[model samples]
Target: MGETSKRKRKRNVSLTPEDITKVFEKSMERASADIAKLIEAITGGDAMTRLGVELEGMGLDRMQVIRVAKYFGNKPNQLHIHIWNGLNDSYKPDFVKAILEE
Candidate 1:
């Protein structure tokens, strides 16, 4: 019979509380920067208003339109697709859908 060799498993390195906190903070900073870039790219001019109008036309209520506008204005950007993909399946807006289709 051939002898089977035992493989040693590597132990996972445990992170300290401070290390975890630092990691969390860095992650949050990166997320904030990403969101800031998206906002900067989408904001300015009457983009928000245009987004509101489009959303309203798509059957979203005024409040829903406002929330969507505040989150993602009409100024086209590379990140818009990411935002659209991140939306809840049931909440995808027609305006974004058209943009994505194009």
Candidate 2:
């Protein structure tokens, strides 16, 4: 029966800010793992010096570097686009290619 009666009531519904925070926290958790793996790849014994120099030359600090890695780890096939669009002219193409190859 479609009987329409105006009744004002407060129901528990998801709020925008709450939803945003929940998603943000979830993503942060995933990014942590991505960052850890990327950090290991960057600072591992053999690649340490070259990796540090290349990242530093691009003027990115540690956190930013991790974020970039997380971004790439999330969608590595788009590495070329990310390197070109995100790093501007600070990074060497060959260096980026080498890292992506690894």
Candidate 3:
């Protein structure tokens, strides 16, 4: 019985590359929708001028700003802290300071 239980536990589920790709694509689509909704909520439908301009003024390049926005968009709470911790140290302090000042 012990050996049978071990064998059952050892069964592995395998995913094909195509399966992985499909899952990834679905996840990306969901994430993109969430980010867009969050941005709209934050900017009140004025994303280009409000959020974009502000982050740009903070000296974050396009990609960095996108990354920051992803954090803000996806995680309105503690999840953002984990994302923030993963940010590069170079701009992290400045970004935090500027945000806090607001």
Which of the numbered candidates is closest to the native, going by highest lDDT? 3
Residue 100 alpha-carbon offset, candidate 1, angstroms: 35
Q: Write the per-residue lDDT of candidate 1 for residues 1-102, one digit (tens) a residue.
A: 333332223345789999999999999999999988877565543445554565767786676665566555443563654555456746756555554445
Candidate 1 least-lDDT 10 residues? 1-10
Candidate 2, residue 22: how far the Cα is off, in Å = 0.6
Candidate 2: residue pairs that collide: none
Worst 10 residues of 2 by lDDT: 1-10
Stretches of model 1 off by over 4 angstroms after superposition:
1-8, 45-102
| Per-residue alpha-carbon lDDT of candidate 2 for residues 1-102, written as tens digits (9 for 90 to 100) | 233332323344557998899999999999998998876655442333444455667777787566545544556354443344455454555555465456
What TM-score does candidate 1 reach?
Answer: 0.35
lDDT of 2: 0.56
Quote each prediction's TM-score.
0.35, 0.28, 0.37
Residue 65 miss distance in model 1 (angstroms): 28
Best by TM-score: 3
